[model samples]
Target: MKRESRQTTGGQAWVVNRKKEDKKMEPKWLTERRQKAAEDFKTLPLPKTDEFWRRTNLSRIPFDQFEPIQSVTNGAAKGSASRYLPVPMMVSGELLYGEKMSPATLDPNSQKAGVILDGLQNALEKYPELVLKYFGKGFQNRHEKFLAQNEAFWQTGVFCYIPKNTQVELPILLASHFSGGNQSAAPRLLIVLDKGAKTTIVHYASSETENDSIFLNNVVEIYIEEEAHLTYIDSQALSDQTFEIAQKRIELETNAKLKWVLDIQGSKLSKTNIETVLKGSGAAAEVLGLLCGNKKQHLELYAWTQHAAPHTTADILIKGTANDAAKTIFQGMIRIEKAAQGTESYMANNNLVLSEKAHADSIPRLEIEADDVRASHGATIGQVDAEQLFYLETRGLNREEAEHLIVEGFYEDIFGRIPVESVREVMRKNIEKKVGVIA
Candidate 1:
């Protein structure tokens, strides 16, 4: 049987078609999430020079030159399994939704604590109420056309739920592979933590295709309920030839805690929107971002913290290095509402420019409607510290070695925050590759 070619510009149809299939294949309670999101996607116009995107560069986005990911019926499954064998997972298979497969099952061990960890399709069939209750509950509605496109077309996704009072020490990993013959990839994630539950999730987005895969767009939604604890680690290594658009939203309830990490290393042009909302008193949220751009890559990251409850605390730290004419932009904002008394939040961003041709910008903003809140913001853009390099060189290090050592130290603060040993080690290895450092 011949497979239908997917259109990049009309990617919305891919999601809409999937929605239809899902409606027939999924439970009735869960259909509302995709339906409402599709409608919201249709109404929300793409952002252009808007307040939120003032410092962003969208001229290089090749929106029309991309298409949805093609079906993996042609040995792609076996190829991926063989490639990722060393990686730990209950199932290294592709993520599927709707009536096509049994909603991509998870390991039975995850179910031992009343947790439901499966793809979106399965959540619809078995835990529709949970998925609908938390989807888009904290994400922003204002964004560019790509965001709407994501809402309209996000069919294949990872879904996880931690039941009340349960604790999951092992982290759950969700990796999205976009290695189509000639197509775009649209993926989504929905995570929920029941009252007093605790869990951690790791999301990895990458392209296995060695060829020119035009584009990949993804959206992820997370909910941390009352007294729940959630730690999320997100990493991206898209093909250097591809374009990427991604959004991540997290909500926190009373006394809930969230630790988030964002890391990026590949892709020609990429934009990320990460945000957290404190909805209950005494809630806490922390965001850490690390980016390395080389070879003319253009990247942008925007992080936001919204404190809507009293005594909430949030902090953000973003660090990155750009080399070989690469460019990076970081814009973050923190808002303390009038009702958010005694709120405290801080935002800091730093960048290391390894080459004169490389460029980076940092914009941090704060809004405090409550006079009793404490907020602070800091930004630094500069080259490596010559004194630090000189000191390292005095210890018998070569010029390249001295420079690499200083840069690595500069990023150690963020590196220290990656909770998982394996992910942290991978982060260090990727850093070494980016800076071409040995050992």
Candidate 2:
């Protein structure tokens, strides 16, 4: 099938169409959704000045020059990733070389209770019914531009579906890299945990080359059924020239639990949103975000947790380190509906400014309509205390070394809560690199 990605004026970024390439043999269901998504991309004006895009400027990016990744249905890409992956993962395979997706089947030793773990193409080929049943179901009401663009032009995706009552003890990992050349990678990931199921996923996205320019538009959807549990960690270390616009939405049923962590360590300009909806009684969620911005980097993160059921609970904590001329924005909100009684929520945002030019903004909000509920929010923006710096320096450390230690202590509370050792190590190393330390 011949396909092409076109860049049009206005809000549309890239449109992938096979109409003139191949239409006669296209499946009816596949063609219709793709056609509708393409139409959405065309009609939906890219939010140039929308409130969502106000904090991070999208006008500077050359969207028309961004190229959509080409899909390769071969084995060479897998071989490349095998040499680069850090054991137990097939990251950066076809997605960067020529293939659009990295597909996998359940590991006999790791997977139990008939769980399904595969890529987008694999699920579409083997489990078409299930894939169609859940795809785009979580965000049917969100009319965001980047979300629609990602749905329309995604070249590859990851799908993890846990069976009812099954528990996966091992942490699943998916690593991906983007090569230089001003290309765009749209990866759509879906995670579904059935009733009483439990699992953890560690996602990684990085740059293949330091000097390369790239744009990443990604979407992730998580569905938690009654009494299920899901822990997800997203780590990004892209090139300094990369532009990223991403969104993650999660839906929780009765007695479900969601633990989410987002670590944004690199990118020239990054804008992301974390949305969680508690639709059933007794559902609970915890959201945490950590970011380190340096050298003119701009990062904006928004989080929203809505409580529509009684006895639901949520907690949010966001921490950041900004140095040089970098800027960071953190916005969090918790909404309790009128019918949701006995709801509990707490939101907090803290930042450490390491330079005089560095800037940070924090906005925490709460909307409560029900009775017998507890909700509170707090935000703080401060720098290293002069007395503490002097105390550390007098103890024999230089300014850089003392500052580094102070920054580490600033994020210790949040870092200690991360369960994965490897993830915490990655975040620590990146922070140390950004903040200077003695060799």
Candidate 3:
């Protein structure tokens, strides 16, 4: 086992101690991969000068002060797994992760349909060949420092597979709960849908402690096969004193369809990347995001959609609101390759600054190589409409109530597009609470 340490300029350092027990539990191939990633993680430097990172100050984060959790014990006995139970709607399956990842439970119908849902470690033991085939296929950038760290240290995660020609009517839930202070966790997720399959998945992450300073690095990979359809919802609500970084990669094949929704609300500082590749003809994708920042929270997101085949299409809409001294940033890009002659894509980001000290930034970019493609990008940043607020105030509402109503109305469009009603309702309530509309 090799131990690596990352030193900060301030003379502080954090060490990652590789456990022999973890290496012994996996096959030789996986062990080799982890070893390679660990080496890469040590050599790869943070992209501080990169365009995506120029706006944020990386040195200010005290990464060296947090201890990386190398192992996890069962959390069920500690009463931490029940936070996500009694979900608002029925689910085909549910996977819970706290200090540890639990065994997945699936409805009989789903299991009978040849669906596979299990903890990532368990899946490696039970379905080694299947997991190995699609393990790292979706990632476009293998050398990224954060990605390398996740690949090297991830110990808790979920693996979900839907067989060909099967349709799971109810959504599946994967929930992760984090607690404690000055601790770091790296969790990974993999979801694969075979040809002509259809399913819906909700990925939710939250923290139980409100003031704990924590660090979370997460990665998710999803593959949609030919003619398959998938709806994925990713929501994050961590503690206000935490630093979170997450990356999600998705690949769609011929005639496949995808609907991706993101709801971000918590974390003292959060940076997320969502990249989708339309690899085959007729593939389509729609991405919708909602960001709500309050207090001193900083939320940032980068969404990229690549049209690599003919007749592929994509649409992205992200709405954000910042209050107090919080800040929000959104960067969106749509790329059409030369082979994607009939591609049609559009990207838009809109933001509202509710307080004088609050700030919001939106960057929309387009790169087109196909002459026949149609692509457009736009962004807008503005404050609440005084006229609308006055109208609401005249209708017997105070200024706070009026602003809350306006914010709600501003996000209604994106909320209406959410495929899961339960998730949409939960996000709505979370936003309401953030806006001080409810206790």
Candidate 4:
């Protein structure tokens, strides 16, 4: 892993453990802003013993020793970007990370409508107006240590702008792989869509080397304006020895549409949280996730849907498999405010245990203040049906082959729903490995 100050495309250097408020004489203007943010972070409290964290063993996370992320000057050390999608993936007409990245490409029509897509650090200086308007506004940290920690430390990120009535045909991929040395990375990603705009986002996580990395403290925030349509697909396949804590927030205005899918199959300790705030009437959100854990790995996921407006709708499905001594937790929530009349929401979680030693938990919650709203949730945990396995074995298949066929059939239902073919294939292969069917 490279140090935080490693050189990259521009003359700019990466930051590590650098705060917004430090008295360093780097740049007075930026220093002042950084200082303010640091002050705010200091005032926030870390998450302690709480109902929300009851199921999670927070002590396992290395919270006390927080370090800055080292930068990568050796672009050749980084791996090529991958997209699990049929749609062609590129940034500014060139394959992503094909060469050293300088500036992102923007569509001509989007450019004509004042849409902007640029590096986060560069955009902070170029379009301060829009950055200041949406950054950290929708994602308010309520004394959470990780959120506050990210707010103080994160420096580099992405900035996207979409003007009214504009639509981006292709999805944008923000894929970066960090091979860790001895430091931690606090990656920050910010996205904004103006009213009546539409776009898709794909963010991937990778590593340069398969070293015993520490932490990838990452955060991503999305702000969708009124009537906007947003689709976000995230894939994380970091090194198995690493630990990752990721958070994604989505804000939707009236009649806005949000679709999200997550495929995670790496890291020894991985915790991912994705939330959607429906702030507009008739707003809708859909989420689907696939994860696999094996060999003492621990995977946790939290998905939340907040209905702040009337007639909002939401649907969520999360499926995964655990083998060996691997463990996984699936927690989901749906909240309907008093004013959110006629809201509709549904959630479901299904898990397949491949080994007797494997463990998994599912928790679904609903908080409703509107009696007129409709909300429901369901969760199931079980092993492969032995009767079905027996039927397959009688057809000249071995016990192992029979079980494999049953497990594949079980996952086919959810995998068929996956919109991205590349992602679907990745999930299929991962699931097969979990069942010891595929190498």
Over the full model, what C-alpha lDDT does candidate 2 score relative to the true structure?
A: 0.76
Residue runs of model 2 more than 4 Å from their true location after superposition: 1-13, 16-27, 72-106, 437-439
Where is model 3 more than 4 Å wrong at Cα?
1-15, 19-23, 77-82, 85-87
Candidate 1, number of clashes: 7
- lDDT string, candidate 1, 1-439, tens digits: 1111222233444554554455465555445545665665555545656776655555465444555543222222322321332344333223332112223334465566677766675566677666777766555454346666666556567677888998876766666665545467666788889899987777666665565555667787888889999888787777788777778788899999999989888788888888788999999988999988988998889898899999999988999888889999898989899999999999999999988899998889998899888899999998976787788788898877776777778889997887777777667766777776755
Ranking by TM-score: 3, 2, 1, 4
TM-score on alpha carbons, each prediction: 0.85, 0.90, 0.94, 0.84
Question: Which portions of model 4 miss their true places by more than 4 Å?
Answer: 1-16, 19-48, 63-67, 70-80, 83-102, 106-114, 208-211, 389-407, 429-439
Least lDDT summed over 10 consecutive residues: which range in candidate 2? Answer: 90-99
**By lDDT: ranked, best first:** 3, 2, 1, 4
Note each model's CA RMSD in angstroms: 5.0, 4.2, 3.2, 6.0
Q: Is candidate 2 or candidate 4 better by TM-score?
A: 2
List model 4 lDDT by residue over 102-207, tens digit each: 3455557667778776656567778877887887887654446566556655644667777888887766666655655545666777888888998777776755
* Candidate 2 lDDT by residue in tens digits, 1-439: 1111323232343554334422444346766766677677677766767665677777656676666675433343433433333333422112222233344534574454677766666677778888888889977756667777776666667777888888877666665667778787777887789899888877777775465678888798989999999888777777789888889899999999988888887889898888899999999998888988999999989898899999999988899889899999998878899988999998999998888999998888889999889999999999878999899989999999998898888889888888877678777777777888566
* Shift in Å, residue 183, candidate 4: 2.4
Q: Cα deviation of 431 in candidate 2 (Å)?
A: 1.7
Report lDDT (CA) for all predictions.
0.72, 0.76, 0.83, 0.70
Off by over 4 Å in 1: 1-45, 70-109, 139-144, 386-399
